[model samples]
Target chain A: MSVRDENIIEVEGLTKAFGDFKAVNEISFVVKRGEIFGFLGANGAGKTTAMKMLIGISTPTSGKAKVAGFDVFTSAEDIKKNIGYMSQKFALYDDLTVRENITFFGGIYGLKRQQIKNKSNQLIEELGLEDVKNQLVGSLPLGWKQKISFSVAMLHEPKIVFLDEPTGGVDPITRRQFWEMIYKAADEGTTIFVTTHYMDEAEYCNRVSIMVNGKIEALDTPQKLKEQFKADNMNDVFLKLARG
Target chain B: MSISVRNISKSFKKVQALDQISFEVAQGELFGLIGPDGAGKTTLFRILTTLLVADEGSASVFGFDVIDGMNDIRNSVGYMPGKFSLYQDLTVEENLTFFATIFDTTVAENYHLIEDIYVQIEPFKNRRAGALSGGMKQKLALCCALIHQPKVLFLDEPTTGVDPVSRKEFWEMLKRLQQKGITILVSTPYMDEAALCDRIALIQDGKILDINSPEEIVAKHQHVIYDVKASNPHQLISLLKAYPTAHSVYPFGEYVHYTDQSGEFKQEDLHAYLAHNGLKEIVIQPTPATIEDAFMELAN
Candidate 1:
């Protein structure tokens, strides 16, 4: 999949409101293809709301967003076909074995039987899931389940991937490994858009957009944000923007 | 040993949770068991607290074997689970009293130890624990754990879902507890938190990776670190990856943290390279490595 340098995801004055409350204000940003852009915010921040609009699952109250070269409002079905999503709550059948979960997700993505088998093998080997390949997902630890969920998200080889709090409760070591897989995918030309409460994880994005209340407070690299805010870590930078 | 494990292992259903993991936490030391979820942090904590029996191995707390001296271990240890396990229907005061009763102690006996944290939630002592805010719940949980004044404290991701400010506050509390001669073993998935501990043991996939202090880990980082920022940050990241000297370029907030293949590349060389690549408004600064950076280096 080839995408121009201009923008793979374009948002113009996007807005989403729930009754009198504006969940996402008039925010606009362009995400280039093959970049890992992070959405940063506190719990009540509008990051998730904005993502819902961009992914075509929730309709925007006004303005516009173009994802995968298709309008979010009119071409939502087409947009869904070109992107993969992994929610904070990973959608997987816990009762199924590792192999069965992979096959099921692959089929959902419309992969052929032989292609699913081939991809499953590569995934199992890359993730080192060989020992527990036949074990039920419910029996696996939280870290292993997280890795499996990520692999399943990329099974269909979509042009872009979206991850929501993909490493919330896992150990730091597993988080580091999860990011390696993310970098590998980015290297292979898959654009990654992720949201996270962990500021350090935000630092791992190609560029991050920080939300406060309902507006994009800051959009830059973790280093620049730290310097501009005169802070040592991403946590400080986030506190400066969010708390202020 | 204040805490000891020999060939300790556990599994939920068919998943091999812990594979003969054994370690010791000395008296009055701040020890960190660092790993993501399912790294057996919970399972190990349960075993040491005598809440769950390991299918294999033997663990002893304060020289009292876990299997044989379970009651003694329970009476002498403070345990705070990842999730707030206190009764939701009970008030803060009730929860504290309930836990104290289990260990044959009273809140009045250890009131001084928990006075600082308890005072913050004292007004809400009458409110049900479920109605308390996240930070408040954390404070209440901590107070209950400390009420008994156990020799060793087992905190399982105590700061997991709490706010950053509260997390910082919680660590400060732990440091204070350490000063009072309490041996603490805390687990967390946040790399930054690992630095606050005296020494950390990085665990993953049921295996121990490395054990060292935060400063030692960062000092051992063998890479020359550079932070790069530009007007068009995302575009700069894409450009940096294709640059000839680029070894690894990952986005770090508004700038990209990069390293070179030789670990000896100069800043002037980087500026020249960026200019030649049509990257403008660039800021390249050499920065000190953090524990998270060192953790990433070792993890890879």
Candidate 2:
């Protein structure tokens, strides 16, 4: 392993154009291993478009990138197998039972039958879903469903996990618990990449990059960003950058 | 009073959405209704706007009863629901004009009222409402709501999905509107936004946890909260939870918000315990509480 291997994600001059519009205009960034990297942006600031490119789902018009040791352009399939993704819409099967949902996701990750059984039991126990394990996911509260969905996303033990606004509508208490899980994942050396509109969540990241008008406007730790912008919080810093 | 509610209560088939919730909004005040997803905010807004009748209790808008004075309230109040409700096929200008006509007025009559917000989206007037971005759609919805020159505006989560910049701009527009003496009542799940309102009512599980200005609410917290961080953040939470003096320990951003049962808690003792537990890079600092802390404390 070389110095570059220490970086879980590396991008330089990444650009994605739609006709005449540059959704992601020549952005560059790096994500160190075992760190929580927050990609912050206002809606329509090209955050999602950039994230899609990083996740290997969308292609960049011009760029150099590597995710989890795989080139994005040629090795997207290999990249997909090494990362987990959870979106705000929640990819869980609503009609499936909590236990069934876990098993189903594990199967998709190509886990063996015995491995799926062990992982499902462990996940259910960790989330305190013993009683509701057989209950349909739709019957659970929004918070519980969100936690379970996040856990399911991590079942395959991917090297990195990408969360898109995971706690958007969740209550503060539940959101706190979700962050606890995220911290646990990071502690275990799984690099975490997340995008959120919530500034408070942005503060939790080790490093954050803010996008404005389809370009990387600022990137630094939350504390430094606040100090550099002469602002009190990420919200104020974001406002200053966006207004500029 | 701009708005008043007396023992307002509503229930669905199985859930009691609001239970004896009562609050008053003073004239020209920017009041915030803060809560989570199932906090009954929408139900309250619906009742106040005369779109739904409360099972038990009454609400009044600008000295008019919501039940008997439905038409009067409808004419004087502007309501922007949680979801965007506009003619998707119609252009931005058409939506504004259509809403203005419904109130028996023209855009020119109230052009000054929405001028600050309208100008931002004026360049896209020819664009269909459906083609606008999230921020643009928000401005368009707000313009349509205000085209009628309502005395009181009821906005339900106006900036929920919008970006930080657009959210800031929207709040600035609200301040301008409030300066013109329009009492605004807004609801949002984001607790950080509570500070922007003149006063806020923190609602949870269909009950108002506490109603007061954001600063006052934070001042009311008797315990001194400490922000605790360590190399192993998760383990730190568990260790702090097991500590005898710990009153409440919850994950807050990059640190765990730890409050002790004993008024005089020792940081040295916490540091010793965390170190003994094999945690590294421990940093403990006293931090001022925010509206979020107050909400968690009250809800508990």
Candidate 3:
């Protein structure tokens, strides 16, 4: 791989303005391939706005970024095709059966009918959902739904996947199980850009960036951040930064 | 007693949301219900607040039976549902006034009860409740809940999605309210917050796992936890779980928390075993068990 191809996501002086207020003010970072990058910030902090721009759903006010080697400005359509996105608020359809939801998402991602069938079978087998593949998603427990939603997000095997608090309000055992899946994915060379409220989960990332009031105040690995801030854990580091 | 429940069970269709749940809260106590999603926390809250009836057993709030004296309980207790229950279209001040008037009272009558919490949102008094930020919305909802100055307060997952800083501040406010002698029954998915309550009841699948102070619950955990770290975390977890004497292996932050099946297990033996597997820099340190660990153990 060339030097440029190693970097899955690249941004420089990225900023987004809503009226007179700048939601994201000149933030820049690079996410390497197969690296688990955690985007940490308080509520109302520009994380979501910045993420929308990178996913090619929202336009930026200024600056530049390249996602999967395509410019977010001119080649947003290409960027969309090369990325997979899933959020806790809006994931799979609850009214649809597990198999139908997988087929629907695969179709939307432009997969062939034969390929969708194969993908559905593989996913159901991996998730141990063969018994309930025909059941409505609403009938399953919260933990099962979360795991199934994650597998569906990887249906197209995009270059980068974005997860927004994929384990909110889930059981502790299931939450850890979800992280295990994340580790396996990263090992297979899929860059992960995720956000979460749990600080311990932040420590699992290869590198984390804490945004305070629209600026990246601190960016480093969890161990280095803890040492630099002279704190015991990521939660304390966050308290010190966001409180300021 | 501030609250009491005896064999309370409620089911929704085929799913047994709450099964034979029973507990009691003392007067002026800060009691917490710690559980994750689909654990029937919300359904129990509804039953205690007199919004829904239980299929079996009986409950009471301040000596008032939940069913026989529903009106009396509703008049003297405050409830904040898991979801944002305030009027989104109304301004913060308007929402507060509306709640106060519903109980045949005014904000001024209970000004002292909520002065500290209300002041934080007063600056945004005219802003629509929907326009406020997430943290600000939580503060406003809290103020509305306390405007009636009830003897007992029920908060359902008030800080579930809130940031750490805001969550800390919100708990401090609750502490102050406790000092004012208002009994609080709160619920949360975050285990860290459970330690702040005077007593916590760990509930799952509509049954109580244990009810006691957070310290007592952690003390009851039988396993001696060790924070184990190695060069390769993925391999370390699998190896630890593969150990014949290993009781539990969980990925916690930078280290994988491991426990042995026997209390007499030695750390050096485990360290040497990992060293033999081509694992280097293997460090194992004993760590104190937390309520989260106890909850998981009890649930298992």
Best by DockQ: 3
CAPRI grade, predicted model 3: medium
Candidate 3 wrongly placed segments (more than 4 Å): A1-5
Query: DockQ order of candidates, best first?
Result: 3, 2, 1
Which candidate would rank higher by TM-score, 1 or 3? 3
Per-candidate DockQ values are 0.24, 0.52, 0.63
| Model 1 agreement with the true structure over A134-213: per-residue lDDT tens digits | 98898876777888898899999988899988878865556656776887788688899998767777776777888887
Model 2: how far residue B287 lies from native, Å: 3.2
Query: Candidate 2, residues A43-158: lDDT per residue as tens digits?
Result: 88899899898889999999889999999999998888999999877568889999999988999999999999999989988999999999888767677888998898899999
Model 1 has a DockQ score of 0.24
In model 3, pairs of residues that clash are none
Model 3, span A108-162: residue lDDT tens: 9999999999999999999889899999999888889989988888999998999
Task: Give the whole-model CA lDDT for all candidates, comma-separated.
Answer: 0.83, 0.90, 0.91
Which regions of candidate 2 deviate over 4 angstroms? Answer: A1-5, A230-232, B229-235, B275-283
Residues B1-300 of candidate 2 have per-residue lDDT tens digits of: 999999999998777999999999999999999988888999999999999999999889999999999999999999999999999999999999999999999999999999989999999999999988989999999999999989999999998877888887899999999999999999999888899999999999889998999889989998899999887666788999999888989877667899999966899999999999999999999999988888888888
lDDT of 3 at B258: 94
Q: Mind sharing the TM-score for model 1?
A: 0.73
| Clash count list over all predictions | 13, 0, 0
